[model samples]
Target: MPSGSLRGQVALVTGAGRGIGREIAIGLAAEGMGVGLVGRTHETLTDTLKECARHGSRGVAVTADVTRHGSVREAVRAVERDLGPVDLLVNNAGQVDRAEVPLWETDPNHWWQVIETNLRGPYNLLRCVLPGMVERGRGRVVNLNSGFALRPDGNYTAYATSKGALLQLSDNIADSLAGHHVVVLDISPGAVATDMTAGMPMFQDMKTWGSIPYMVAVTVDAARGRFDALHGRFIHAGRDNLEELVRRAEEIREADARTLRLRPYGPQDPMG
Candidate 1:
């Protein structure tokens, strides 16, 4: 049965053709949300849309490359026309390097492609959608982040760099939009087995994988504004205990934890 506080809300999920984005779209639909599936592949998005309808919610697929400004505007318009103003925007589309090569050894073209897709894509979507959200005085944005953002990795430079910037983007926008009731959050799906990751040599022999349901649960929580207090913060679906995180929300806020920031040398530092 479709059940949740987000029942009648509208959501737009980029990269919804497959993998984590696909699952998130269906999960939201199962919770009775009208969903707009955004992706580059029409066939795959159509299939996801069918699954969403089966869950008893309205679903529409808009094929568009997120990296393009025109495409993003079109997708946002289509979603709003069909599903109403997007109450939730999931910036799930992403790209990683073709191989695990060091930054100095990476292909320049492929590296830039990853940057454009992973970073510029979300910027485009936000530009297209944020105006309407601000006008409405309420909205939520969930950026699909990764542990690679914080942890230093030898390879996947573009992916990591883009995500780290994305985290900052969420944090900055979260603060800017706070009074407007538009919360932005960053979530790390945490090494989930997906089509994008399936081909990675790193996970070839891995046994345990992150839970997709748990990731979806966190997404839904963001959608319902359950974690608004933690806006602009990072949440790791596969690692931290969410209930405990909720209980420690105040401590987190007070300590300015779960966000990217610089550390001072001491309490008497210049800035301090």
Candidate 2:
């Protein structure tokens, strides 16, 4: 069950022009969140806008290439001016330039492009967004990582490495900004039938997982901080084992909260 409400909040979803990002944007809008749709192409973004409107949300579309810092900064400013201060950021923009090449055989340029789009792009957005969130004392950040981040396969060197870095970055941010009421999480939405996988020859051989709607539910849940106790944790969508994971997260949060109150000097104390 989806467990969060985002009424009146503003959410920015990168790559919202299509695929998983589009689904996430629409889902947030359906849940009463104002949405900012961003993508490299305006036409694709317009499609997202229509979806948002259909869901009865205040939506704005912006064209920006995530790989460029200036472009992303501009997009964030536009979103704020058009919507409101961004309360949630879904770092969903990513690329896979080394899809079928071994690490040694992959072109350096392709590898770098993947890394730039997947890792640096998110870093740029966070740098531009986090300060405002800290000032507001509330925020949600969901990095769209992959299952390969935890378990990598061959011919996915670029994609896997970038997501791995993103997961680490999310953990580090979660730890550093816990006191600011900011929740940073890495969500690994299992294989969805997106364009990224549509043309892969072996795509059909893999197990079909949950659809985009399921991932959207998880995104909305994370944005409301319903999973705040799970900060720094990686969540896998549609996996039946999440109940235990959520319980453990709550336990950890309770423990952390108690420690903060009991011993302010503890290492885990955000105040320290």
Highest-scoring model, TM-score = 1
Residue pair clashes in candidate 2: none
Give the whole-model CA lDDT for all candidates, comma-separated: 0.90, 0.84
lDDT of 2 by residue, 1-272 (tens): 32226778999999999999999998899888999998999999998899889867899999998988899899999999999999999999988753576788889998999899999999999998899999999999999988777766678888888988888787667777899988888888888888887755557687865678878877887886778878877777856366677778777665653111224577888876
Query: What is the C-alpha lDDT profile of model 1 across 131-165, one tens digit per residue?
Result: 99999999999999999988777778888899998
| Model 2 accuracy (lDDT, Cα) | 0.84
TM-score of each: 0.96, 0.88
User: Which lDDT value does model 1 have at 224?
Assistant: 80
Give the least accurate 10-residue stretch of model 2, judged by summed lDDT: 254-263
